[model samples]
Target: MTRGSLRRIPLRIFSGLLFAALLDSQALAAAPPEVPPPYIAAPAWVLMDHDSGQVLAEHNADKSLPPASLTKLMTAYVLFGKLKSGNLKLDDRIDISQQAWNAKGARLFLRPGSSVRAEDLLKGLIVLSANDAAIALAERVAGSEINFVAEMNAVAHRIGLDHTVFMNATGHDEKGHAATARDLARLAAALIREFPEYYRWFSLKEFSDGRITQYNHNALLWRDLTVDGVKTGQSHSAGFCLIASAHRDGMRLIAVVLGAQDENARVEDGQRLLEHGFRRFETRLLYAADIPAVRPRIWMGDQSTIPLGVGRNLYLTLPRGWHEKLHARVTVRESLNAPVQRGQAVGTIALDLDREPLAEFPLVALKQVGEGNLFQRTIDKIQLWLQ
Candidate 1:
């Protein structure tokens, strides 16, 4: 084949447990169409499969609405960055300002004109959804809530939260403070994936600040053992909102509920969304980064061949019975030359399920290749001329 032309090749068949699972899935493949996803009661909601980053179900996911205290998810993400970069420390004492002390809605009740540890303040922000704690942490990290909110908006843009706008760190009722359910779901997933170390604090049921104790506003943690950390919010204008995450049997799902009727409605909406995702879909790992499933020939190079595969963990989320219909194939560009770098795109790995397009990922070189020897190069040049 000429340069830039594609040569198609099949991947080796699976064996062992994966084979058995696929064989089992064959029976389920011909079943009736999947049932409709659960109906969410909130004004906006999203259910995301964490492993695959796929939206299983959503309603009004892109409509801008008040996030209420759920805005702290972004605030916590910012603070976690400061902690990781050594710009701030958990033990650092933050001097309380009048603004923080007077922050209404939810209060941590920090002593007037006293200093508090950054770690404790985080606990209050996440578990208690305390407005005062959000202000204090903002001041500690960015010198003031105003500056911290700027940092928050910058981070939001950097992380692909294009539909969100943060007016305050505490998620108070501001005229312009808004985030879509889809954006909030992405934000929650980012917090879980980027800061596993700090995410554990969100699961705390209760936190004590010497004089007072407050319980986490996310009620799903108490109702379901599988449910873990996430923030909750309620305001006169925003209604009730919850971003709930739950893990079961190695699979995790994130559910975002916004503008629910009441606190109980938010929890119920979020839980049902999570349940719908785990029950209807399953996430599978297809390939690990740097591990090649295909090795096509390489011409006029130091190496005779190059392995082609994904550059990151490749995952697919599908209905429980569709695994048997998922197929992967590679199409490599022909007549590849020398000096290919590791991780450079070489071809395309096309994925299809039930004979329909699912996703496509770049098949990359698993190893580098340099020029071939002079003698080998001369012979290859002659062979190329003849062809």
Candidate 2:
């Protein structure tokens, strides 16, 4: 063949390869099935895996709205903190003030000048959503409701709840008393994490004083065995709200719903979110803080192999049905130099299910790997040069 013909042959082959690559790309793009949106009817909602903090579903989750009685969750959190700190005792008696007795929201029938223990007040607030009980507790804790509200806001800031503002511990529908579903979920998470002992109060289906019995507002507790505690709320402007948590198969999930039409709607939507999470997803431990997940090569270092670990516990929430399809890929430098400190990011551990990356965590050096001596360095350099 002539010189021009020879060049044209290779050009034609290259063009053919390029065209085939484009077609493959288009075909692959088309091959991926579209994922349908979650089934939800709430105006604002969020569902997250408790252990992994994986967001399973969200709809206007950041939109601030009246929290109603769900604001009590933060109140409960603050009270629990005081209890844990020994500043308040559950058995300590509280005198009901006129302000607490005159509170307008839900009531536990607390009478002014009556004495009730702190634990009993907590039961009233959590189980009955009693405004009187909340006010009494607030005043007892901080000397006034106004002062208690300042404490609530301070705790909110410390917990990273940026969108929440508490005007009343009872979650009354004040003009500026508002929070987002995401914030409420975060509050729930904090409650679960910080005061696990106190969280049991949320699971009480029925609580009673000597004269009367009050049932919990959360209906899911009776219907679902997995569901334990959380809170619910309702008001004219707030619509209906519910924060529900369930534990199943060693996985815990939190669902928050806001702006539903009624109690039934709120419960139903919350249940749906919880069901979707538990049925569809699972929690997998990817790595532990001190446990090495990968072994990275070391060059010009004191050690031949370096252990790579996660800085914190790594947990992933992925599709339950896709567990068999899960795969892990650890990417690290073929060889690392000395002076590697503990907790320094050495690489990444990527987790994939169904060929899609679900989560990625930083792989860090588990221990300090120092620079090698002159003799070892010379040997490593010689070996690398030979290769």
Candidate 3:
């Protein structure tokens, strides 16, 4: 080629590369701006990333304390599960027993011998923290409050709430009824995540029963546009407890405050936690389910490769400034014996930030691999011996 033509070719290649680099830089710059950390003051509180389940800030998060009306969160959780399972319906009418109406705390103005639909009662229990409504729903679901409490504890365990115990449906500060801030946040998250339809009850600012109109005790619901429905609790011993969730700019956060000195403090602390969560962090989807992270070698198996996957969806909650430092490592067993079942956990994928372990999820087998036949096994054994 002529010298001039050769020089022109080089110039064109350089220009193409420069244009691609500029486009990449512009795309990165177009990403959303990071939030700032919020200011807060409360003795015991927790801020968590709603999508990733990462603890952003914790102060006495696991210290066991009376959940007070926060106990109603568990009550609502059980009721929601029942509704989802078809055991209860919105329009189903429930008879108000004397025990439910006269249980002695947080009445929904329910009158004994009166009938109300399951859906309205739930609103009373969640929005109003009505003890009567909670008891009524519990009785309807499990035949008795005692049995229903058992189911509540069972669900708590299933949700990995290790520090929770349910003594009654109303969160009346009774003996043995308590949960920590972290535990309550987990319960709140479960409700929002597992039962989005039923969780809407928390968002209702007002509900009436033809005689009286009750307002939600959670003050943040009205004060902050980002705040949404979550339960609040108060008692002489439990002080004021709240599980508040809010969504801002596509990010959701759950904040829990237990044993605050007054109603104002509870709301203030909750807002602080939420603001901090939204400001300091961002939720990023890491890897999805059934997406292979690594290939596991099978010993004496017919298949040459076993695809490794996570058991559930994976996400990471990281500081906005540390997005570039996030990293992941997949650890799998060197070799597996035949007879692996699909969905069986075989390993773990650990997510780290600056070499610190942030989250770990079980890595599972994506497909089943049957055990080799006797002849195949014998051949494999010979091959192994040779190796």
Candidate 4:
């Protein structure tokens, strides 16, 4: 081969290598983003966003299993609803019944005939996971534990807990008395959202009734600064379970770990799930509620255009640093006729990421628009026909 041809051969080889490198770079850039599910040592688990009800991650989240003390969450919810509706008062006294006194598992150590303040029992029920306190409160509201279990089931159904069934108010293990991690997550979010005033008790590290002092079983509260009130349950059938919530940077997340091997496993696994969630994903306000998102042209209306917007603020949970990738498309009818009522659904607003819809909401009229005068309608018809 000629010397010059040999030199050209080296240059050609270098160019080929450079082209291959560029192709590899392009392939990496085009790859889809990944947020792998965390490794949690539990039979069933779920992590969710508080504001949006978005399930960030899960494994066996829908499987029904023993919930142990997490049943107390329902008990607390029932009492809170009563407090809100004036059926029960915080200071109202409840006479402990024989059944409540003989209740099993963790308890407030109430005597059969002794009277305890309803508020104090709430403190015991929540802070100590007191079986006695749960029963006493149940009897106070429903006259018996069986009736109170019925009330719990009714509320559970209303809140969309399809997999949850309550045999007793204290969360004792029994056939058919089970709840899934997803349902428990929903219950936790509802408890926080529905009773903000009463949720403060969950954050209390310790509660005292002038004799015995009980600390919250949720260790996350002391370990993580953002961790707040929640419930933990442990039983031979259920293993160890914890439902915890944490708030950071205006975002709140609920974590549930069920059937862990032990208390430490539950706490560690719960914390790992929460940290994985907060670290790997973030919550973003996609669009403000009640703010005009778009104004579409109106036909045969007193106004030339009608304001369109979402009814409530739209929030989305996405992989961290992915907010900029979100895009929204407004869909509306070809023409709108007036007498449009405010809040009338006229169209839909869809949110997309990577060209796929992640969520959608109804687009509604922001203001009422009356029909135009007959002459105006006629003119509009002529204009449309001319076009």
Candidate 5:
């Protein structure tokens, strides 16, 4: 039964949808393909729609492999947290150690027994892919690189990077240190979403310490004006890897290319993947947070009904012009009685594209509804019993 046909506690199946865009099948450019045509030539790769949390294209995305210098992404993530929490400051000077000075793969030319500003170290790690800067930042935060590695792993697991294991902060070639393409994509998304203020640093094409200047290894910054900050990695084992993010026409996409042939190939793979996502798919805003999708009866409450909605702005991504077949079915599992608190999950809203399940989200109370007075409760009870 449809949501509107029922007078009693009802299920909101999409006989009539809450969103008109889902049903409006206007010409939205030619459909790209039923599936993302194979174009990328990497061991593993993924293209994600950042707004909808959807993977538009992926290949062997779950296979764990060394991420190389991309491990520095995690180092910056942890350090940004320290700065955000006021435990550290950009101007604060961090002491460099001999071990960090001896960092093997890449160096920021940091010297032992000398201190550098946190901001400069951060730029070095981001712009130059500096191993020495990664080590120094880790030591400054966690007393040692080993301890910092533990923190990195903990954060990884907590943030749902199940296939990842970080052995160092530098993304160096180390045994037992690997990350899946999908996990790395998620990490980049998290870094951007969590630290937007600091994330602008990734877009800096070049960083200078007055004495020396180095350019960012991520070539897309120069090639594509739409592309912004992200990272790149290379190693003998991992070959080459890059995670790039681009914003265009109010949509953002994250593309991950791992185990590529060379630096140029990785850049090409990233650009191709991002272009594929933007060209092939479209993201739509489904529901704004705290806005009611349905107002269900709240028996024995101060109010007659409570507005139920999502906790955050809801978005859906699908192949171009395919939203015509989308259906959002909401099922209210609870009786939806009084004393409902704001943000309480009352039911689930499920989505189906062409009758195939696509996504689901919790339907939450948008505002509090207190219990009714004695007279109101008595009347509601009688009405409920009769019904």
Candidate 6:
């Protein structure tokens, strides 16, 4: 069902007993279909809706684990911030440091003192999973890897990645370089939503620098046409990890699979989560932002009524067959007075799954309401006293 099809609960001050009765009546409104989430194969995994920021399914989603190359997602986030702030440029040449040249694991074969464009380094960091490239980019952005890691952690905190910490630029299995599936999913959403312009690079299948060519490690890109991006990581300590995003029809999903046994297991787990999310859940835009939801009477005001609504669109990620059962209740202040300003938090909109509340949204005054003239104010005062 669409947004217009949703049955709205009328504006009314419900008595406690009446409210409880209505909840019972609402519970029998619709017989919701059974759509259970599939079991995720990884130790830590999360499937999230891109538009509504809803978690469809997860296992050990908040458990901290080594990020491996999944740490690169945060690295890319920090770099994207620098690029947006004009602190770094894609075309600017970055000097390769000795530390980068001597780095272990995947390599871009950059000789010490050789200058490479930041754009090229990005390709190496993503497609190639090059440790040296990650270090070089980090050094260029923060002057040293040590300071760059600090920036990464700071960005993690700023973005509300509560379960993430970075001890190095590369997803090298350091003692403290760790992240959770939930945090990685949030990182993936931030990268795609906040920096769509730069996120395009994650879709590239391969990057070749004359002599050597490197293909992206994410296998879903080849197997599924809708699969686009994200990143992959692996180490003895962290296990194989993959963060993947896919767009199907008009919906997009981000899947994080960590601590898988092997490459195939990680890829399979990510694919399964994405498939289940798209098949089982559907995102519906229920309410437009800043629109009048309720008109509650204002006492002693020039205008007798004031509008109320949430400031943003209310998009709900619901089960495939549960749309008609969804309804919302509007609760407003009992003693609303004159001089109410626009954008004020006057009430709340609570969406319900029968008697259980699915989500709650704030209701705000849509327009200003000036105090009434002396006569109206005096009448309201007398009414208040009589009550």
Q: State in Å the error of residue 304, model 6.
A: 7.0
TM-scores for all candidates? 0.89, 0.80, 0.77, 0.86, 0.88, 0.83
User: Backbone clashes per model, in order?
Assistant: 0, 0, 2, 0, 0, 1
Model 6: which ten-residue window has the lowest total lDDT? 16-25
After superposition on all CA atoms, how large is the RMSD of candidate 3? 11.1
The better candidate by TM-score, 3 or 5, is: 5
Using alpha carbons, what is the TM-score of model 1?
Answer: 0.89
TM-score ranking, high to low: 1, 5, 4, 6, 2, 3
Write the residue-wise lDDT of candidate 3 on 195-300 in tens digits.
8777777888999987899899989989898888788888988888888999886567899888888889888888878777777787655555556666656665
Q: Candidate 4 regions off by >4 Å?
A: 1-32, 299-304, 372-387
Would you list the clashing residue pairs of candidate 4?
Answer: none
RMSD for all candidates, in order, please. Answer: 5.4, 11.1, 11.1, 13.1, 5.8, 7.4
Candidate 1 residues 76-176, lDDT tens each?
Answer: 99999999999989999998889999999888887668999999888888888888989998998789999999999999999889899998998989999
- Candidate 5 vs candidate 6: the lDDT winner is 5
Worst 10 residues of 5 by lDDT: 15-24
Report the alpha-carbon TM-score of model 2 versus the true structure.
0.80
Error of 5 at 295 (Å): 1.7
Over 1-387, each residue of candidate 4 has an lDDT whose tens digit, in order, gives 211111111000011010000111111222236689878879899999887677888999999999999999999999999999999999999999999999998988899999999999999999999999999999999999999999999999998899999999999889989999999999999999889889989988998888888888999999998998799999989999999999898778999999999989999999999999899988766555556777777879898888877755556566887766766667775567788999999887666667665555677898999999999789889977997
Clashes of 4: 0
Mark the regions of model 1 whose C-alpha exceeds 4 Å error after superposition: 1-35, 375-387
What C-alpha lDDT do the candidate models reach, one value each? 0.81, 0.79, 0.75, 0.83, 0.82, 0.82
Task: Record all residue pairs in model 6 with backbone atoms less than 3 Å apart, i.e. clashing.
Answer: 69-233
In angstroms, the error of model 3 at 58 is 1.5
Report lDDT (Cα) of residue 44, candidate 2: 94
Q: Please tell me which model should have the higher TM-score, number 3 or number 6.
A: 6
Comparing 1 with 2 on TM-score, the higher-scoring candidate is: 1
Compute the lDDT for candidate 4. Answer: 0.83
lDDT of 5 at 56: 83
